[model samples]
Target: MQHEAKAARTVKEDRTDYLTEERYGHTAAHATMALTGTEWGVTTWNTRPRSVGRVTVCASNGPFAFQESISPVEARLIAQALLMAADDAEKAIDAAYVQDEVTA
Candidate 1:
């Protein structure tokens, strides 16, 4: 099946068209450890339509030529999972340090 291409719309346009309340957004970039000269951007926007608040996450990797848009719920779930993973990573690091101290 051939997919129809829709006209690209900016975040501002999306907010203006769909959102009808307060807006909040944030963007950040991170360097990829797996590839040199690769950067990934994460942008989150708060959108509310008639009191139902939603979030949109846009991710892009220039070097990899990839982009994605994530819905509000999916973004929240992913964020929670990431936070848990980070906690686990920190615990592992602390354990390693404790082991080194015991050995030394």
Candidate 2:
């Protein structure tokens, strides 16, 4: 097995920030993440055989992390689940904000 370091770059504009990294070769891999306020968007590429991907979600008080290596089909399922979960969470937060405004 051989080890290689990926190249990474960061960009910031106004209140938004972005970071991108790439390992550009036969086993090409890439990752990019962006942040604006409390929201984030992430994308990744895993071309190496039997590669594992990890995701960590955190809050001001603590962090939660998950990692796994699965078949390409399973990867799509997991990604869809995560997106739906995020959407549900955002809706819950919006509802809370509305309630707070009504009570205040």
The runs of at least 3 residues in candidate 1 whose Cα sits more than 4 Å from the true structure, single-residue gaps closed, are 1-37, 44-62
- Tens-digit lDDT string for candidate 2 (1-104): 23333333332331111222333444222232224222222323334333334222222211533333355576578779989999999999999999999999
What total of clashing residue pairs does each candidate reach?
0, 0
Give the best candidate by lDDT.
1
lDDT of each: 0.48, 0.43
Tell me how far the alpha carbon of residue 89 in candidate 2 is from the true structure, in angstroms, after superposition: 0.2
List the lowest-lDDT window of 10 residues for candidate 1. Answer: 16-25
Clash pairs detected, candidate 1: none
User: Candidate 1: global Cα-lDDT?
Assistant: 0.48
Name the TM-score of candidate 2.
0.41
lDDT of 1 at 92: 100
